[model samples]
Target: MTLPAFELVQPRSLRDAIDALAAAPGMEPIAGGTSLLVDLRGARVKAETLLDLGRIDELRGITIDSHELVIGAMATIADVLKNPAVAEHAPLLVEACRLFASPLVRNRATIGGNLAYASPAADAAPPLLALDAVVELRSVRGRRQVALAEFFKGVRKTARKPDELLVGIHIPRAVPGTLSAYRKLGLRKADSISVASVATRVVVDMAGRCQAARIALGAVAPVPLRVAKAEAALTRHGLTVEAAADAAKLAAEATSPIDDVRGTAAYRRRVTETLVKRALLELVEKGGDGR
Candidate 1:
């Protein structure tokens, strides 16, 4: 199908790209173009200009800075899947990336686009939310950082101002004792949107007592969510069958699943609870990333 009339900007620098976005009357930035191409062809996202950001050197790949693991917005899912630092420091993300589309799409799909689009069933958001990730956003005027918890506003919605470009994703450095995992319920795994997704990250003391816990869920609410009630139940508890089961119940309470073509809200709710149990129990029984 022929695309509509659109001007293209190929900026050599991020500053030039920002200016281009600010100046275009109806401009949108694109990387990979996987999602936007569909929207543009369907006439769902009307834009007279497309600011392509694929060449921006500053916005790509993975790095372990002194303070955190910095991931550029333009980094492809495949890049993430193969990066050793990401696998070592943030395996939860690696796990999620493993389940995102296929090798063909992963080679093109970017973290920035996925989080910016903010689909409720997106595999990345829950794990990032559980990791306490931060996103760096830039506008013509300045830059700001927002925690992932405050990022997603609703289904297909986010806190981003229209002019802001999501520049990078920031994840805390993984240290010893930090344990994390990601779980997704897809119809048959390949090319399936999540029926339910959950991510759990916990730090256990040498004696096996939980020192910290974070539980985030997706495909059950309008946005990926942290189950505060579930986290509370785990932080001081032991890593055991009973503790995992109890946290799963709290996670179920925090969800507000809706009936959809994928499954009934009730079904989604139950699966979320089960997924949480599996994640936590798997951690207890098997230890860290099966790697």
Candidate 2:
């Protein structure tokens, strides 16, 4: 279906983009237009004006500063895959990008757009959540940072105000002896939304005990979630097979999945258990390189 008619405003700068959004009540920001355009065409969302942020140079880059990887909001999935900084600091994010969609979609889909869309099945959300990422939001009033965990309010909803623009995503550099992995279960091998996805990050001490653990899951809840109960299970005990199995059970119990076309709630819970256990076991075996 063709998209509904809407006025398109191409902003040349970040300030102009913010001003445009403030000026129009129903003005929505568009970066890659990958998800927004689809929503518009399907009549899922309506906007009287679209504030195109593609021309805004300030919101586009991948760099590291002060022990954090700063990814500009406009940075595409392909950009993240190619950036050495992202690979070094957040390799699991790269894994998500590789499974994001087809190359065509990856090239045009901005990381900001993906998060802004706030799809529960969004491939980027799980890894970013596990990485303890933070989003920088800017407006005429000022800038504020929100933790990724708190950013998603629900499915297709977020904490972003109408007048605010997501400017960048900041991820703390993975510390030494940190091991991470990601797995996505989808109907098709490529270009499909996740049925259920898991991203795990484990910090191991010299004695091979889990110092910290983050287990983030997607498509099994209203928002991508970090299973605190499961993390606690791992952190409480050494990274043993028994501990991993117990954590997996706890993770499955924590999910509030729904029966969707991709999967049933029961099926999702089962997959979550399997994936979480596998990820923890893999990390335990490979150990950490501090990368």
Candidate 3:
């Protein structure tokens, strides 16, 4: 199907993009056009104008500043895989990128577009959530930062206002002794959306005791979620098989899944429990080397 006719506006600067959004109703921002184009073609979404952000250089790089990794909203999945800063600061994000889609799609799919599309199965959200990432939103009024946990309001919905543009994502640099891992269970080995996914970050001391844990789940909830009960089960405890099992059970219990073409709620819950346990056990065995 062909996309509906719409006016395209290419803004040369970030400020110009913001102004365009503020001035026009029914103006939708387009980064890579990977998801938006498809939505438009299918008539799932409609817009009178397209605000192309590709030319705005301000929204297209990855940098580290003051102990945080700042990724420009326009950075593509391929860019994430290639950037040394991303690899060093957030390797689990790389894991997600590798599993995002085909190479062709990865090259054109911007990180901002992925998050903005707001799919429960979005590969980027779980890892970013586990890393305690924050998204920066800008508008004519001012700029505000929203925690990744609070970014997604519901299915295909986000906290971004109509006139606000997502400019960047900020992630705190992982501290020493922090181990992280990501797992996605897709129907196909490649190029398939997740049936259920899990990302984990565990901070452990040399004594093999857990100081902190963050377990984020995707595709099994209305939004990507950090299972606080599961994290609490592992926190301040020995990283033992028993603890992993208990935490896994809690994680599974927290999910609110629905029966979809890809999977049933029961299947998703079982996968979530298994993946969480496996990730925790792997972290314990590797002793902070979650490669």
Candidate 4:
């Protein structure tokens, strides 16, 4: 099917792009356009104007500061996979990127777009949430930083205003004794939607007791979510078999899954528990240090 006619506006700068978006009532921003183009062609999205963010060079790089690793909104999945900072500070994101779509899609799928689309199955969200990432939103008014956890309002919905554009993602540097992992279960090995996904970051002290833990899941709810109960169950507890089991059960209990074409709710819930269990066990085997 052919896409409907629309105006494509490429701004010379980020400020100009913001102005273009503000001028149009429901203009959509296009970075890689891998997902947005599909939505446009399928009529799942309607837009009269497309604010091209591609030309804005300010939105396309990776940098690290004393505080956090900053990934530009336009950085493609491939970019994330290649960045050494991402591997060091947030290996969970690197694992998620490896499972996100295919090489062709990853070469074009921007992380910002993945989060902005707010898909329940988005591979990027779980890892970012697990890493305690923050998303930066920019508009003519100014810029604001939002915790990734609070960014999503619901399925395909976010806290971003219509005129605001996602500019960067900031992931705090992992502590010295942190161990993290990400796993996604899909109907097929590749290019398939997730039935369930899990990302975990655990900080273990020298005595092998967990000091902090973050666990996020996807494809089991209206939005990607952190299982606080599961996290609490792990923290302060040694990564013992019983603690892992308890956390896995709580993770499954936290899910509000729905029956879908990819899999049934029961199957998703089961997979969720299994994935969390395996992730935790793997971390323990890796010496509870994300190396």
Candidate 5:
């Protein structure tokens, strides 16, 4: 498929890029061009100008602050998987990256693009949401931070304005007893979109009680969701068999899946419950304290 004719602008700095986007009518930012190019060719997106973010050096890097791990928006899936800071502080995100796509696509797909695409099945959302990640948005006007939980407004929708560029993802450093796991139920293991997915994080105290719990699900709703009921169940019961059961049931009930080519609504609900239970059990089998 051929993309519609569009003016391509390559800017050396973030300021220049934002300037171009703000000046052009129907201009959209492109990073990696993995998702945007396809959308353009498929007529899913229309644009008269394309602002390429590749030359903007400020939009790339990985670092750790005293309180959190900061990953540049342009970082690729491979970059995240190999970053030592990411591996240590956000293992659930690393696990999600492992299941993202094939190597060829992963090399070209930026984390910012994945989140900006705002697909219900985006592999980046559930795990990052579980980690209580924050997204940094920048524009000619100024910069602002939005919680990942509040980033998505709906399907293919986000709080990001047309002039704003997603600059970074900030994830809090993992606590000592934090444990996290991610699982995606795709039709095939490689290069397939998830039919249903779950990511969970639990911080268990030395006394075997869950001090903090987060359970997030994707592809079964209009937006990626943190299942508060399920998290509460785990927090109250500390991942016991009964607690797992209650959490699973709540997760299944909370999902508003629809019949689609990937899966039936009933199938997704059932798998959601099973996967949530399995992930909690895996945490338990790993010695429960997340150490």
Candidate 6:
């Protein structure tokens, strides 16, 4: 199906793009156009004009500064995976991108589009949320930043204002003595929305106790959820198989899952527990933990 007739504009600067978003009614920004194109085909999304963000050089690169990992809005999954800095400092981002759609889709999907679309199953959100990322939004009014926890409202919904464009994302550096990992369960190896997913960043004491932990989940609720209760249960606790299992159960209980085609709610709940258990155990093993 063809998208309905629409005007297309390529803005060269941030100011020009902001003016366009503010002025154009029923206008949509296009980075890779992966998800938007699908919605357009189904008539689920309609736009009078397409604002092409591809040419905005300001929104097209990756940089790691002392303050945060700064990623432009237009950086593709492919670009993210190829950046050595990402591999070295933020492997969870690379892990999520590795499991995204196919190579074809990955090459064309932008980080900004993925976050703004706010799919419950989007792989990036869980990791970014775990990392305490902040999303920067720009409009004619001004710019503001929202933490990942506050940005997502519900399934397919976000705090993004109608006239705002996502300018970039900032991920605070993982603190010293922190270990992080991500895991996703789908119906198949590829081409499936996440049935369940988990991202964890854990800090351990020199004595191997969990000092702090962040557990962010996806695909099991209206919005990506943080298993705060589960994380709390693990923090300051001794590393043990029993401890990990119990934490997983708490994490599973935290999800308000609903029945879906990929799996039943019961199955997803069970998977969530199993995934969290593994993630926790992996952290211990990598840190040379006896547990």
What lDDT would each prediction earn against the true structure? 0.86, 0.91, 0.90, 0.90, 0.89, 0.85
TM-score result, candidate 3:
0.96
Steric clash pairs (candidate 3):
none
Q: Mind giving the per-residue lDDT tens digits that candidate 1 earns over 1-291?
A: 988888888887789888877776356788878888887899888887788889898899689987799999999999999899899889999999999878888999899888987888878889898888999999797999999999999977888887788999999988677888778898886887899999999877666677788999988999989999899888756677788899999999889999998899999989988999999987777553222
Indicate whether candidate 1 or candidate 6 has the larger lDDT.
1
What are the clashing pairs of model 1? none
Candidate 4 lDDT tens digits, 238-262: 6766777889999999999999898
lDDT of 2 at 257: 98
Q: What would the per-residue lDDT of candidate 5 be over residues 182-256, giving only the tens digit for each residue?
A: 889999989888999999998888887899999999999999999999899988877677788899999999999
Going through the candidates in the order shown, the clash numbers are 0, 1, 0, 1, 0, 0
Is candidate 1 or 4 superior in TM-score? 4
lDDT of 2 by residue, 1-291 (tens): 678999999989998888877877478888898888998999988888888889988899888987899999999999999999999999999999999988999998999989988989888999999999999999888999999999999988999998999999999988988889888999999999899999999889887778999999999999999999999988887677888899999999999999989989999999999999998888877773321
RMSD to truth, every model? 2.6, 1.9, 2.0, 1.8, 1.6, 1.8
- TM-score per candidate: 0.93, 0.97, 0.96, 0.97, 0.96, 0.94
Error of 2 at 83 (Å): 0.4
Q: Rank the candidates by lDDT, best first.
A: 2, 3, 4, 5, 1, 6
